[model samples]
Target chain A: GQQVMQIPQYQHVQEGEDFTTYCNSSTTLSNIQWYKQRPGGHPVFLIQLVKSGEVKKQKRLTFQFGEAKKNSSLHITATQTTDVGTYFCAGPPHRFNKFYFGSGTKLNVKP
Target chain B: EAGVAQSPRYKIIEKRQSVAFWCNPISGHATLYWYQQILGQGPKLLIQFQNNGVVDDSQLPKDRFSAERLKGVDSTLKIQPAKLEDSAVYLCASRRVRRDGNYNEQFFGPGTRLTVL
Candidate 1:
């Protein structure tokens, strides 16, 4: 079984603060995908990073993959109220068939 | 284009009863998956289908949970003799299984929240 662990199980920030969540896995991943789920809502796909040491961005959100492909990080700059949710990173569950999700980092945006 | 569709946004059943969930994947996608999310946890894969065929069901509780994707279209997940711990959100997702593509994002449905008494 593969394990993907996320840190900072909970985070609270003001309307214009910043936040970051880190993900680590016991096994090397061929690819890693990030998702966000609002309170009481299903997960929505955010972005995917495949190459080792790769970095991608969506406006204020930046995603990075470790050089060994065993870890990842998602950083939010000047977070907004819309950024409130739990962020999860997923990889193929067993040798690339299904997917396994991280416990997630719950972000609360304050006004 | 319509997103993945799931029915009966919420359900409450007693233990030992049977319940079923339906999912309609995004148009033209070939891969579908079923996941269960307990309160305060991430989604866990119950099963995955590759166009009407089972790709993975290793994590599914075979004795109580079952899933099918007949004809590679709408899929259903059933939990017979439901247990009290079966209370959770059942999510369905679909993606285009790539043969030569690099990105095949899995689009998830609104999910069916089930509660067992």
Candidate 2:
């Protein structure tokens, strides 16, 4: 079975502070996708990284895939109150049929 | 274009009872998925359908849970004789299939929150 692990199960920071969450897997992935779910809301797709050592940015958030393709990270710069939500990383392993999701990292920013 | 749609945003049922949830994916989307999300956890895939045909259902509890996607446009998930531990939010998502036969960028619906008492 394939498994993905996320670090810092929960994080709380000041509105102006920064936050980062890491996603790691024991097996390499063909592609990785990021999602955010607000309290009482459904999960929303954030981004997807497929190539090794790939990096993508969306406004204040930056996502990076490890050179080895088995790890990834999401970093938020100068978080805002609206950034409160849980972030999850998911991907399917090579030659696998189903995708696996990380436990998720909940983020809370104080005003 | 409209996003995925799910009915009965919330539900409450007693143990051993039965419940069902419905979902309609966006038009032209060929892949649909059902996931279970417990409080404080990520969504876990229960089943996946590719155009009315099941692609994966290894995680589904076939004895107590059953799902169907008739005509490849709408889907329904049913739970029979539910238990307390079955309480969770069921989410439905859909993705567009590319010409290369790859699917990406899943869009999720609001989800149905079920409480088993």
Candidate 3:
């Protein structure tokens, strides 16, 4: 019953363009976490990925992990306007500790 | 090192009335969580604790919700007759348990924004 799906639930982009968001998972994940909720604020913990196909960066923001760890991705380059908000992707369900969230990806950035 | 601490950041009962929310976590951290966020989706675990027992609540909503975290620390969550979809926002998170047992990175508070009218 593990699920974590995310897509372009919403995205605007303009400040400079460039944004990406995608996460998938139905089962299979030992690690995967990323969050950011700005607008009203609350969910903030930005990176975490464990091996598999790992790829992490946090300046212009870039994160990927999927070699069968289910799936994950987050990219944002030129975007600015503080980068707007919403973007979540959590996981857990291999050994399980209870975590499953991913129905976010709202980014707006429009200056 | 003080983070997760929720309260009545905002609330507006109505439907059936009855509310309760409070949390304090982030001292030695023993894992505590409770989420609901429903405006757009994401953040939905209803219950989880590890120190005061209860490791999962299967998504809570036990007839109308309920929670507690006695001696292990502080915690509370109640709903009673509330309805109107129960409104949203009610986050409280805390995590720290990594002596190899793994699992850290949660710290989230400033939530509680119910508005059931």
For candidate 3, lDDT tens digit of each residue in A5-39?
Answer: 89989989899999999999988888899989998
In candidate 3 the C-alpha lDDT for residue B26 amounts to: 89
DockQ of each: 0.81, 0.88, 0.28
Choose 2 or 3, whichever is better by TM-score: 2
What's each prediction's TM-score?
Answer: 0.97, 0.98, 0.35
Task: Tell me the lDDT of model 3 at A66.
Answer: 94
Tens digits of per-residue lDDT, candidate 3, B74-107, equal: 8999999999998999998989878887566888
| Model 1 alpha-carbon miss at residue B48, Å | 0.3
TM-score of 2: 0.98
Error of 3 at A3 (Å): 16
lDDT of 2 by residue, B1-117 (tens): 998999899999999999999999999999999999999888999999999999999999999999999999999999998999999999999998889744489999999999999
Give the per-residue lDDT of model 1 (tens digit) for A55-77: 99999999999998999999999
Best by TM-score: 2
Off by over 4 Å in 1: B101-103
Docking class of predicted structure 3: acceptable
RMSD of each predicted structure? 1.2, 0.9, 14.0
lDDT assessment of candidate 2: 0.94
